[model samples]
Every structure is written in C-alpha cells, then in structure tokens.
Target: MALPEGKMDVNLSNTAVVLTDPQNDFLREDGVAWKLVEESVKENNTIENLEKLLKAAKAQKMKCFISPHYYYPYDHDWKFAAPLEEMMHSGGMYDRKGPLTMEEFRESGADFLNVLKPYIEDGETVIASPHKIYGPENNDLILQLRKHGIQRVILAGMSANLCLESHMREFLEQGFEVAVVTDATAAAKLPDMDAYAAAMINFRMIANAMWTTEEAIEKIASS
Candidate 1:
C-alpha cells in the first residue's frame, strides 16, 4: 500500500533547510548519546548525507537554519521534564556553560558536528536560540524563518523521534511547508523499541512531504 505523499515544488527564493540538533552529541562517534543511536546513524549514512544537504544548500545559496539543543546549569535544576528530557539532563547530553558564553560551548559536545561546522559557521546560516527541550516552541526559529521570508522548509538532522519530530510538528502548526529528508536523519535503536520505525510513521503522517538525501539534493540543484 502507498501512503498519500505530499510533495513540494522547491522554489529557490523561499525554501530553506531547517536542521535540528546537528551537534556533536548526536552525530559524533564519541558523543554522549553515541552509544544509543550509533546503529541507526550508521545505517542511514546520516553524517555524510547531512553534509550533502548542507553543501547543496550552500551551493544554491538557499537559506539554511540551525535549531540546536543545549542545556545550561539552571535548566538541570528544573523540577519536571519528559522521560527523554530526564535522560538528557541526567547524562549531560548537551551541556553548555551559558547562553552568552562560548567558553564551554566551543568544541564541546554541544557544538555543531565537525563536518557541519564550516557550513554552520560560514556567517550565512541562521543559528537560532537553543531550544530548551524537544521542540521549537521555546526558541526564535519561527521568527527567524519569517524574517528570512522562508515558507518551504527542508527539514533534516539528528535523532528522528525526538527533536527532529518535535520541530516538524511545530513548524506545521506555524503554517510552514516542511519536507523531511529520511536518510539525513536517524533515531535510537532501543531494545524492542525502534525509534526510527516510529518516527518514519509520524513523519509520513505529519510532514508536508518526505525525501531522501539524494532526492533533496536533486530538488535543491534544480531549484
């Protein structure tokens, strides 16, 4: 059976790539959560595919935005969080010194993945405020998109079931056309629980469209 797939005719002028949590803690081999998501990450060729998208966007001069995850000291003191947030807090997943200080953020696990750094730090990508939790509700991402006159969002990046999914949901609610790149993202392979499997189902149902890395690159090239 085939799912009713929604497709976006990529327009160079208004299309942007919104990448969530493309940080070391999720993409690097020695990252804090590396052990948990390694299988899916490798299987998806996530790192290379993410690079491909970034390179393509750069080449086309299409705008790209980064919605990162970070945890400051005060955040850990919070009294409540979802189960996954609890794990993130406990494991110090995206620990950073503070918002204004780059002392601990630079080259930290919370930093952008090494391969992605050149693209993110090229002074063109719009790096929004760190999302305190799983979604963009607490950040300036929507505003950033609106500011850039971005309407079609090519969404990609780490951990399929968590931040990526959450971002997709919120972007839809905010009236943006979103297309997720499946091969550019991955999820945890927990025992008897395939996070990637669950995320793919939701992505299909909620996103305006879904594409693989190759497909996204092609659309970007033609846009």
Candidate 2:
C-alpha cells in the first residue's frame, strides 16, 4: 500500500516557520543533553542546517514562531513523569530558576541558541509560552499562528523524535499543513535506541512535505 503524497502550498502571508526547542540544551556542545544527541546531531548537520533555515526566514521576511521548552522550580515537584521527563528533571535540564526570574537565564540551558538570537529576538518573531511537554498542546502556538492567519508551517528544530515530531503530529490534527525540514532536526541516540531513525520514518509517514534546508529556502523565497 502507498501512503498519500502531499505538497505544501507555501503562502508566506498564511504560512509561518514554526521552530521547536531551538535552545541551548539541544544545540550547544555543553548542553546537558548534548552527549545523548551528539551523534545524531553531527550526522544530520543539524545545527548548521537550522541556522540556514533561520537565515532564510530572515532573508525572506517570513513570519516565525518559536515553541521553547522550559521548567521552573515548581515543575520538579510533579507527582509523575514520562521517561524523558524523568531524564529532564534528573539534572535540571532546560531549567530556568523561576518563571518570573531571569536570574542566570542568560546563556543557560533554556536560552535560545546565541547565533540564532538576532532573528528570534528581532521584535517580530512570536515566542510562545514554553511547552512543558513534547508538543505545542500545552503552549499557544496554534493560537499565535491563527492570530496571524497562518495555516501552513515550515517546521524545524531540535530533538527530532520527541518535541519536533510531536509538534508535527499536533499541527496535522489542528489542520495546519506542516512541511518538515528534515536535516534541521535531530534526536538523541542511545545504546538501546536509534531515535533519529525512528523519527525519520514517522516524518515520511506524516508531514505534508519533507524538505531539506535548501528546498525550504527556495520555496520560501518564491512564496
């Protein structure tokens, strides 16, 4: 049996680049989860590819939204956690001292990648409330997109098997056309799991379109 093949109708006026977890904890070498994701990140050229997408968004004047992940002190007190949540809580991964405090927030694990900050902080990009889980269901991404009349998305960013993949699935359910920039996302590889491989399969099975950074940039430029 063959799955449906889909293509995106790139309309910048009604399309936005939705990036998930483009933060230090996922992209930087010193990040808490770096060791776990390093191989996949390097294998996919994830960081450089993500930067390419960001640069394209800027050059094309594309609307952009970031769905970040963050955990304040009170978050640690939750009565239960999923496996990844346990891993995140164990070492204060993506931890911000407090919801209202920026104390030591600069250059922290939760901060956006420094190289990508100019575009994200340009006073135009919409930064949604931090999602506590793997998807945007807990955040305001859909609302933000709707407010701007965005019905299609160019999706990219960190931890392919988890947050990014989760975001893709949610967008589909929410009626947004999602095109994943495959190489711009990566996942943690463990002794017992090849997460990135798993995610690639799902992306193929799901997303309306699967594009490389160059392809996405071209579409955006022409859109």
Candidate 3:
C-alpha cells in the first residue's frame, strides 16, 4: 500500500528505523516462545518480511536502531510473571538460572543475535530496552533516538498489540512522526492475532502513517 499523500514525506536523511524487540525471545520460528505465538508470527510473516526490510534499510544507508527486551529477576512486576509462567508451562518460555547478561544471551540458544548478525557486524546501533514497560522510565529508546536527531521512525517488531502499540503511542505523544510497518510485528500468543490487527487498525487512525515495507522503502527512497 502507498503512504498517504497529504502527510509529510519521510526525510530519509534524518530518519531512523526503530526495531523493537525483534529478538529470538520473540520473532524466530525456532525461538523459545515461538510455539505459543506461532500463529501470530506465522500469519504476519514477520520474520521473512522484516528481514527483507532490514536488509533494504541497511543497503540504503539509513540509520538503524534495534531495541531488544530484557528483564531483571525480582523486579516486582508480578503481573508480567503470571502470563510468563503460563507461556513457560505451554513450552513458550525459557529462563537462564543466573543473572541477565549480554554475554550469556550471545552464547545462549536465542536466535536473534544470529538473525541480526549482519546488522551488528556492520556497526548498526543496538539499543537494549526494558521489557513490558512504556515511556522514559522503561528505557532510553526515545532519548537515544532524539540524541541522534531522528525526526521520523519506522517501527517494526514483536507483540504488536502490546509493546509495539505502547511504543507507537509514546512516540506520537512525544511528537515524532511514527510509521508502523504493518507486516513486521506479531502478538505473543496465537489468540492475540485479532487483537494485534485491531491495535494496528487503531494505530492507523492516530499514527502519522501505517505502511507496508515496500511503501515505506519507496517513501524513503524518494526522500
């Protein structure tokens, strides 16, 4: 689909692609939690489509920022723990026995590091963000983007009905032009696909624009 004609066209010279939680903990077919959310990810074709967009963005020399989700044990977020335990029970979650460590994540079975290896190797900035929280208190995603002078953000990644929606709302509230890549995000469970779709539809109303990867790329290329 094409971008809306009346909106301010993306200025690729100053645009950044904000990839949120495109991690093995979420996106990969062989990922730890894949089974629980397979339907959402599968139906959206998120991994395949996102890989295509990521490669194109990199090739076009656009600034790329990847946000991965992490959590600390005993963080007092029990509401998050219940669903997580359900996921674990259903074979959709995994946990390392020790403290969270990037080194451990790199060495672990998570496929995100391998999937995004090219971007990392090519010096793309990877910003680790907190899981399941919104706004500045959660993490410094928006601040980091602003620091880089990013005025427009093309958002993609996991849990479309939750984290993606929260991030989009925060971006809009902060006055950034936010464009959600429709085919690049999914829900945490199969049953949430409808919820994901509903959220996307709602986002389309309030966001600067909602575009497919091709439309976003063309818009960028034109700029």
Whole-model lDDT, candidate 3? 0.68
lDDT of 2: 0.91
Q: Give the Cα RMSD of candidate 2.
A: 1.0
lDDT of 3 at 149: 90
Winner of 2 and 3 under TM-score = 2
Against the reference, the lDDT scores of all candidates come to 0.92, 0.91, 0.68
Span of 10 residues, lowest total lDDT, candidate 1: 99-108
> Per-residue lDDT tens digits of candidate 3, residues 23-118?
776655567766656787788788877877788787778888866555444443355556645554344233333344555666343336466667
Give the candidate order by descending TM-score.
1, 2, 3
- State candidate 3's TM-score: 0.80
TM-score of each: 0.97, 0.97, 0.80
Could you tell which candidate, 1 or 3, scores higher by lDDT? 1
Tens-digit lDDT track for model 2 on 30-148? 99899998998898888888888988887888899999999998999999999889999997799999888899999999999998898899999999999998999988988999999
Prediction RMSDs, each to the true structure: 1.0, 1.0, 3.9
